[model samples]
Target: MSLESHRAACAALTLLVACGPAMADLQVAVGATSESTVALKVEVDRIVPLASLHPRLELRLATGLLLLSSEEEDGNAAWLLSPALRWTFSGERGAFLEAGIGGALFLETRVDSRELSTAFQFEDRLALGLPWASGELSLALTHYSNAGIKRPNDGLETLTLGYRYPL
Candidate 1:
């Protein structure tokens, strides 16, 4: 398939997964760094009802944008959509620690007239969350990189506070 077609397909699949059941949890977060760069994210889980991994391991659809970069070579913004798998230490939720790893396709990997070597990258996350009465609050650190698949693999890191509300 053409690159445009592939991007369309990926977007459609992301929407299909993110718009799961009506009862799923939706999370929205905005994060900023000292360098004046910003990141925005929205995420939800697609239920995979497996008895062995139902509550412990969950599939998440994470969509985000990195914008307003301070450095010139980093470009303006990078849009990312990734299907992630999270494994929580506490299987049934509540207070937990989770680790997630996934591959992301970017709308553009070039910034400031420079190419970032690849449009495909890997996303890694680590989070600690506690469920409140109506929602869950999480502190997460995320990283994105090309994994040296191409030259000039400049990686990014963002720390965020996220909230998930049942919808």
Candidate 2:
């Protein structure tokens, strides 16, 4: 990872920690990507009530791990932690944009020559959710990247369909 990426990661984490006490929602989610990989993630999102401002706002801080597997190939894993800002249009039904910066550690044994690489990953996702009695179904488009640290860093773009249950 480059110095700049590291700095950015640290700064984001610091902000998340400072703002942790205000957030109070816990969510567990599961989703699948276009690459035939599944992701299970959990998040604690706190709504920052901004009644004083127009069009109320909320912020989220989340940390989770993603385990990726291919049926015809070996599996890979990544550790993810991100902080994001969200603006609500109508409480239950709204659009949100979030960005996450984390570390992606690829498994060495699965590679062709036992090569291992760790890179800084950043992802941006846009989501829409339909709230249910106990959970919500979310549709999202996500772009994942290694921030140019690795050669041929043609990042993975995925469309994720997910369900989240409040926990």
Candidate 3:
């Protein structure tokens, strides 16, 4: 994508971030990739359910904007705007399994040695979480890839321990 397009995408995401507070929960997380590249993420998620399979099984549609900055040599950051479908299966107490899938617009195609080849990527996430201290704590693994839409589709994976507090 051109520099102007990236800037325009950023501006649009900024507008969503500004307006997200009225209907969603703000989430901030700090983590690192398997290569030890540090990263910070800011997101907003809303609970939009699709079904209630069981008393403990609930499916939700979460729409959000994620701004991610990582410690790559080039200092390139990514802005991901996508809608995720989350499956929350309750267990003992407040513990649950979190799984989500979505697509993202990766602002930068090259990060370090990975050449994604395209700005569009798919996002998959899995987490084990529990409620604690009026917030939710989770250990999450997230992946980003283009699903072979283009050549040299190198993917990125990140593991993060995060806390989400509803405002």
Give all TM-scores, in the order shown: 0.67, 0.63, 0.77
Tens-digit lDDT string for candidate 3 (1-167) = 35675576567657657867774666667787555667666666666555455555554344444444444454345665535444455543377776777777766787567788988888888878888887788787888899999999987887888777776
Minimal lDDT window, size 10, model 2: 107-116
What's the lDDT for candidate 2? 0.52
Model 1: per-residue Cα lDDT at residue 67 = 44
Q: Model 3 residue 140 lDDT? A: 79
Show the colliding residue pairs in model 3: none
Q: In candidate 1, what are the lDDT values of residues 46-68, reduced to their tens digit?
A: 43443575657766655544443
- Candidate 1 has a TM-score of 0.67
Ranked candidates (lDDT, high to low)? 3, 1, 2
Question: What is the C-alpha lDDT profile of model 2 across 50-165, one tens digit per residue?
Answer: 55664546555565444454554454444465555656657544545444444443322132222223345666666666666666666666556666666555556446566655
Q: TM-score for model 2?
A: 0.63
Using TM-score, give the best candidate's number. 3
After superposing candidate 3 on the true structure, give the runs of residues whose Cα lies further than 4 Å from its correct spot. Answer: 1-17, 49-51, 63-72, 81-93
- Number of clashing residue pairs, candidate 1: 1
